[model samples]
Structures are given as C-alpha cells and as structure tokens.
Target: MKKLLLGSMLVLGATSFGAVVEDLQNNGAKPAVLNIRVKGTVVDPTKYSLIVKPLDATNTTDTMQFNFDGLTIGEEQIVEGGYSAGVYQNNILITDDYKIETSLKRNGQNATTSEYDQMAAAKLAYSLGEPQAVGREYRGKVNVKATGKAKGSFVDNGVNLEVLVKNI
Candidate 1:
C-alpha cells in the first residue's frame, strides 16, 4: 500500500519548484487550488490546480473533455463529456522575492498534521513579492456560467500537461 501511494504521488504531485498557470473555461465550473500546492520564496498561491465542472443556463451540470497541454480550440466542437477529464500543468510558476513554503492543510489545522494529510481540500497562501505592483491586474478571474464559449488554450504549453484552456 505504501508503494502504491508513493507511486501515485510521484505521478501526481511531484513538481520540483516553479509556476503553474491553470485555464478554466468561462461559463464553466473548475475548482481552484487542487490537492497539491507549490512552494517557493516569492508567492505560495502564485499557482493552483484546477477542476472544471461546466454547467448550463438553468444551473444544470455539464462536463467537458479538456487537454491542457495537447488540446486546441477549434480542434472540434464539443458539447459535454462527463467521463472526460480536464488537463493540468505543473511547476509553471512565476518569479518573486518573498519567501514561500508549501505544505498540506485542512479545516484550520497545520499543513503537516496527520488529519491534513488525509483531508481532501487544501488552501494556499500568497504573499507580497519584491517590487509589488502598485495597482494592476495582478489577479485574474473567470466566470463559469456557460457563456464565453470560444477558443481555449493553456499557459506555457511547452511544459508537461501545460495548456491555455479558455473559451473565446
């Protein structure tokens, strides 16, 4: 069992240390800050994992198959694919100066406790980087209510599982 779990960790959460840009389709539902968070010396929440759960106008749930690294928009017109899974890119991080640390957390406990290890949800904290932006669009937000259905691609597609996934 230990070997199996360790192997799984190797496959899923094995990033050295870097940036991770995630793309969630507009008018779609994707969970931010997935199971694993990256550690660094600048910002801890600079990157996050995604889980897309697209929905319809009437609040009906719809799923779509996405390829964050390999799939391109106009590759084909898609309606919904429940069994389909979204794509991901790892260690696609940004540059900063603040000291950052990565760990696991749940509820309100520390990130390394046994309970946090078994918890399903994790939260990441972001700190100020050197030469902070006085006023700019440092943060980005998307609406996942099934509206902006256009082209999609992941950021830094050259990396593993990297995709610029977004609707036009």
Candidate 2:
C-alpha cells in the first residue's frame, strides 16, 4: 500500500509537471497597433486662404511620412479637412489641439490663440486652423496611425485617403 501510494503520487506529480511545462512552452505576445487615418474638411470663415495639406502623398498608397502644407480659404466658403485613423497611435496629438471652447481668435489683446494635438485613437475635435492673419477661420482634419501585430486588432492593415466633403 505504501509503494502504491508513492507511485500514484509520482504519477500525479508527473502529470502536473508536464502541464506546467506545456504552459510554459506556449508563450503569448502583444499585438502591435494596426492602422490610423484622418477625415474631415477645412472650414474658412476668413477672407484669405490657409495652407493645410495632408502632409505628402507621393505614392498615394504609401502610409509613411505624410507631407502636406497649408490649404487656402477665402470668404464664407469653407475648405474642409477630414481625418480618419492612420497606422499609428497619435490620437493624443489630435486631441491636444482642441482644449479651447471658443473660436481661435487671430490677434489683439482678447484674442485666444490656444491649440493642441491629439492621439489617433482619441475622439478628437478637428483643428480649426492656425490664426495668423486677422479674421481668418481655417479648418483641418488630423490623421493618426497605430502599428500592431494581430489581425483585426486595428493594427497594420488596409489604408485609404480621399478628400471627402460631408456638407458642401
């Protein structure tokens, strides 16, 4: 009986040890960020044009290093900028641009010219453009991107960029 109990205990211990070894062999990994983009339009309540572009689209489909200058806006017409998500997690950069509640004033003593950026995942308010000239309102969409490893994880996958105007 003593030998039997010892052998039973040894078998149970072997099974447990094997299970632990199997679990240790199967290590897990973190998924990288998938993708990010920008959407929206540029609005101009000013009397001049602003230079705001989506960085650069040299290859059209190359999701690396966007290079856009400022766009132009004149009179009551609004040139919009829309931002979707990109292949990066820079939504904080987009959110950082919308801390103020009022329209960004151009100049003068009472002019409030505060702005920020937002990360890609953040539900951010689009940039209202930088106020340099007097009486100018420019609108822009901040695009962001996040990279990841897993599938359907909002990480590196498909990407698109079209100048779509919602309300024209």
- Top-lDDT candidate index: 2
Return the TM-score for candidate 1, rounded to 2 decimals: 0.15
Give the runs in model 2 whose Cα sits over 4 Å from its true position. 1-28, 35-37, 58-168
Candidate 1 lDDT trough over 10 residues, lowest sum: 154-163
Candidate 1, residue 127: the lDDT equals 18
lDDT of 2 at 50: 21
- Could you give candidate 1's per-residue lDDT for residues 1-168 as a string of tens digits? 999899656544432121233446896576556444354333334454332332233222331222222223333222221211232235343223222222222343332322111112221121111221223112221111121223542221111111123321
Predict model 2's lDDT versus the native: 0.29
- Over 30-71, each residue of candidate 2 has an lDDT whose tens digit, in order, gives 343434566664444332222233433332232323221111
**Per-model TM-score on C-alpha atoms:** 0.15, 0.16
lDDT of each: 0.28, 0.29
Model 2 weakest lDDT span, ten residues long: 68-77
